[model samples]
Target: MRLETRDLAWSDTWRAARLLAHAYRDGTIWAAAGTVAGWRKQASLTLLYLAELLICRWEKGFALGAVRGDRLDGVMISYEHGERPTPWWGWLLRSFSCLFAGPVAVARCVRISNDLERLKPTEPHVWYAVLGRRDDSPGVGYALLRAGQARADALGLPGYLETSAGEEQVRINELLGWTLRDEYVLRTGAVVRTMWRDCPVKVAS
Candidate 1:
């Protein structure tokens, strides 16, 4: 399968959102709270992702896509040191947008955010906010990971990401050189793992 990586355009936001909604439909923290199914839930998830895309764009962060031919099969959203911890207004907007998923889902999302914050790295790093691949796509996830890591290396910054995908993602991160920093159980009972990857130290010849 031919895979091409590029910066995601504003026009591609909805398409990427749909891909993430379906890709995480059964396994993400959203799914654990029943917010990954149904039309309302899907719509809310799409809006949430769209908000994230816009936030990343505003921060001059990376919102990348891995396309297989004309289809966007994978997405990776990340922000460098000074760009993360999205501003208050962004969170407020995200929470408001998620209202359509119902109170329970919104509350769970908030709690998950809190949990992630508690586990975040104390030092400056690139935050990999979201990484996902289409259901039928294979290997694209790793490609997306590499794309984010490449940016982190270029900036000479460590990388951080929290995953609710459990062991599978943990193993992938490990294979990609990330170390497990911590794991916590969210209020919704989903276990999230935070991983870290130090930047490659350049050595003198």
Candidate 2:
């Protein structure tokens, strides 16, 4: 497939939401590890689908992408800037998140969110990347990673992403020289692993 990567605009949000939903479904075991057994029904799934948009896309310094020759076949979303000393805003958001998603759900989300933040390097220019790949192909995933990494390098920083579900993705990260930083077992027995990777090239002067 002749694929091209571009920065997402407003028109892409709706389609990107759909793509994210599909990605979540395709990786359901990964997305809802602890809650899947309880919230496998339509309502829970719907709420969760919305949750992705509310938390992941709504954050600042986020990038969303649709990979295709002309239209979007797959989508990638990421955030670059985040708190280093302390995520005070993140803590506040989690408090609000508990109201919408409930306390237990909020706890799980906080754990996952914190892991993503910690995976980011301490370098001044580093930005955390939260990536979801639906098509399940290294070609597609790597393309997204490359595009995001290029943007990060352009800004004179490193990029980071977390992969918890698929072994194929773990291999891909290894190929790209991503290091495993941390792992945690969710209440649902899903094991999540955090991964980090520095940009392959230096930023242009």
Which lDDT tens digits does candidate 1 get at residues 36-120? 4477777777777878887888888999999977889999889889356577878876875677788887777678777678778
Top-TM-score candidate index: 1
Clashing pairs in 2: none
Worst 10 residues of 2 by lDDT: 36-45
Candidate 2 residues 16-83, lDDT tens each?
65555556653534344344333332334334444444455456555556466657755565555543
The backbone clash count of each candidate, in order, is 0, 0
CA error at residue 192 for candidate 1, angstroms = 1.0
Q: Which ten residues in a row are the worst by lDDT in model 1?
A: 28-37
Alpha-carbon deviation at 108 in model 1, angstroms = 2.0
Q: What is the lDDT of every predicted structure here? A: 0.80, 0.57
Full-model lDDT, candidate 2? 0.57
